[model samples]
Target chain A: MWSRSNTISMIFVALATTLVCLYARGWGYTIVQHIGISTDFTDITISAAIILSGGLAMLCGADLPVVLIIGTLGVFVSLTLAQDALVRYLSLAAVLFSIGVYGMVVSRNAVRVLMSIELMLNAVNINLVAFARYVDPNLIRGQLFAIFILTVAAAEAAVGLAIVLAVYRNMSTVDMERFNLLKW
Target chain B: MGENLTALTAWAQNHSETTAFYILAFLAIPFAYGVLLDRRIIRSGFLLIGVFGAISGVFLLLQAQFLAMAQIMIYAVGITLVVVIALMLTNPRLEHDVNPAIPVAKTSGIVVSILLFVTIYLSLRSEIWPLSPSPVKADNVLQIGTGLLTYYSLPFEFASVLLLVALIGAIMLARAEHRPPSQMEERLDAQEDLSSERNDNVVQV
Candidate 1:
């Protein structure tokens, strides 16, 4: 359904976002002296915004479910934008983790499964780092756990890819349906 | 000019974290969805890198600078291997792209993910976090290094050993020769013949 121009533009948009994030000099100074920014929009508000905005996007004929996957994430009004809450970070992590779970279950490709597992692990890492920053920043106990998870995830990825390659060598196919050796 | 500058700085200070988070999360979700559902398997591998990079941005937003760098470094290496493996296993030149054909997995996967998201989000909503009054120190890298070497040294050592073991194990597994399906079938046939001979002997006895 994506035209060439549309696809190229999407890539550009993603690149622009990545650049802005990587190069932004100001990393959200608290500036509690200047202004104390807070938001009245809580969890309920965000949830409602996602559903309503996503439904409207679907109505506007952007793709069906993939539009819903992210259409609302970037829609926060500037007034409601800067809610410095632990739950905000935690919620993003949850969304990523859920998508990873879906990938792991639905993908017939073994490599996709491994990628999904990595995604899930990164989700956990986000939670750890969020806790480190918000709850125990001085001690950084959560960052410690995040490091371990990263290590294990790397090891697991390496091993999982090797196993997939090995299986592919023998079977000459990477389809999950074909790898039915243990299936009774 | 000074007034204008202060206004811009104030606005930036107020909105930067949430703006960064939203942008990265926006990038991440679609790429993740692509990783799961893209027809081209190799493309999915590439999308995985996008997802990783965005999450690393999230890490940076949280002020875990060291972990953010580590996220990029580690996932860079890991995702490279994954892409290589995808190339080795799949032929994008073939007529049929790799798509999930299982109707059951499709429906059930969506249902399960929705369930998981709801459970986790609802659970998180009910809980109150103990917020720290103190701001996070700027010297996070130093703290992490000291903690790893001092308090968490044992686990740190254990992680290194685990990495080494995984390295050797992956090499061994990938390097091992694969028995062809024909040879495997031959071996199975030979086993069947032996069992049949044993059955005859039992019948005679």
Candidate 2:
């Protein structure tokens, strides 16, 4: 399957799941705050419905592509359902990390591999922000740390890509198993 | 007893249950998945994310926001990125084949990992975590900045220099040189006689 289509479908599913979870959790205000959308509902009743639908979709022996899309969507929905900022942040981080791991383990493209790592980094940044909110409501140290991490990540990416380029020049291919020059 | 109960009730009222539930779920689900899954990458990634997420939550609950942020940024983001990038540089292909001859080694690795997990779990369970006497002050950022500039200035400068040196080394190693290798041609020439002899043997056979 073309990854482009898969990415789009995954994003759609995530949006739908978030909507369902918000409806179910009776926390319409939370979603409203996140997307700047206003809605009136003291207690929404859509969480159970979405969970059932999602579970059924998973159990239908769907294609791997479909399952991956739904799984990613489910993660997003679950995270957004969280009511507290800290929980929401952690959930977002978890989803990002899991997606990154999936991409790292499944995709063969170098760019995809790098993207997965970036996703994981973003998850950590979210966690940092949440934690900072918890510890000191006034301090922005968490944001600073996140910036530092981003800087380091950028440096690492540069060095890593350079190495990959060098390896490609020498071998004409990036197949890992072929790099056996140092095995002894 | 009445006073203690009132205090407990006040604490519970101030805190959000949704946060606690999410944290617990995140921590438990990954561990369960790790135990049930056969794939190492899946298991490891899930476990790491769960553990880190839980720690971050605890940090938030404990009011050590800066430390928690550092934990997530440094340990979760930095380390995971390094590992994933390393994986990418080495193998872009997601090959699932395992060497049949490495069963014993694989088993040993699994055993060791399980043992380490158990040890850590036990220690965590036994530890007595104390709540902060007072909520963290709002000026933690300023304090951290002051500490970094005053007490940690030398180490910070050294770390920067070390990073620069590493950057230079990485660039040097990765830079492509157009010049022909001096020894490679000589080595190929030396192997020519062996190739010719093998060709002769094949013809004679």
Candidate 3:
């Protein structure tokens, strides 16, 4: 039999997060005012909608990929509604980062895990470039940092895949569960 | 005909960028979804290319033309291809969905990941990100090039060195083998040999 208790608990958590996201935008107004950047309240309701949808998806036991796409698009759409381009870009990055986190946690394959890590790095790059565009347009340090991060990410992917390949050769399986040689 | 054309152009002139953003998002998100959730692992590799391409388009929208170009060259083409190749090299044929996580583990993963997202979203909501009043430099490419060669020259060189080392390491890992083929490799090799032999026999007959 399906565990209804866990499902109810998940719904509560999702609802809680939705409420938090809606209220948190207001909490940040004073902080943003200090930095001379004005924040918009237009996207809070949208974010709440998204959180609710995500919770519904979980309750319905929808496919993982569908849930991820919804999460990403929800953030993207909400952020795109913002007046400040920096906030928009940063929100997109945050969403991508969370998706990466999800992928890393759920993936069984080593290559998929590497792909998730790459996604996270790319999200960080998005944040960097957004900052460069908005924060220090004169110097453009953020773009430079983004480039370095990209290079480092490439190197990491290559090395990570190599390690995975090496492991595969030895063990004949890329499943993370089977990679507990060090456990014993 | 001309009236319709003019109206279309007017619409494009007004909303083309937003339209492009929507198009690219439509293309990117689903493919990115495929990259993570597709039961077919190999297909996910291909979907990744679409995701990267769409992301580069977003970079273009952000006016990071140089970064966008680099994204296309580096991530869209280079890294994605490498990932696909790695996927092919490592995975066994007929490998469908492999159930690695138990049901409880999966549910927990979902909870944890959603929580993580909520935490990040709340923090971002609470913080103030600075924004420059002025537009980006006109000659962003030139400025970036100069910055790379001058101020960030050392790190730039280090990245190249790191890439070279990684290339060498990957080659060694993938190619070098003293022992006989493992079971999966043997199965793969056998399939290869059988196909080749079949081709040869057909040619002779």
User: Interface RMSD for every prediction, one decimal?
Assistant: 1.5, 8.7, 1.9
Report the C-alpha lDDT of model 3 over B36-126, residue by residue, as the tens digit: 7776777877778887888888788777999999998999898888898888888534247456343556767767866776787667667
Report the number of the highest-DockQ candidate: 1
TM-score of 1: 0.73
Model 3 global lDDT (CA atoms, 0 to 1) = 0.74
Candidate 2, lDDT over the whole model: 0.51
Worst 10 residues of 1 chain B by lDDT: B92-101
TM-score of 2: 0.46
Candidate 3 lDDT for residue B67: 96
Q: Better model by lDDT, 1 or 3?
A: 3
When candidate 3 is compared with the true two-chain complex, its DockQ is 0.43
Query: By TM-score, who's the top model here?
Result: 3
Q: Summarize candidate 1's per-residue lDDT along A70-107 as a digit string, tens digits.
A: 43243322112344468878878888898888888877
- Greater DockQ among 1 and 2 belongs to 1
Task: List model 2 lDDT by residue over B1-205, tens digit each.
Answer: 6996787568557766554744454463444233223233333433454545565665556455666677677656765555455445544233334321133433343334334433432343344533223444667667667756776677557657657866796788676464568776775676677557756866676
Who wins the lDDT comparison? 3
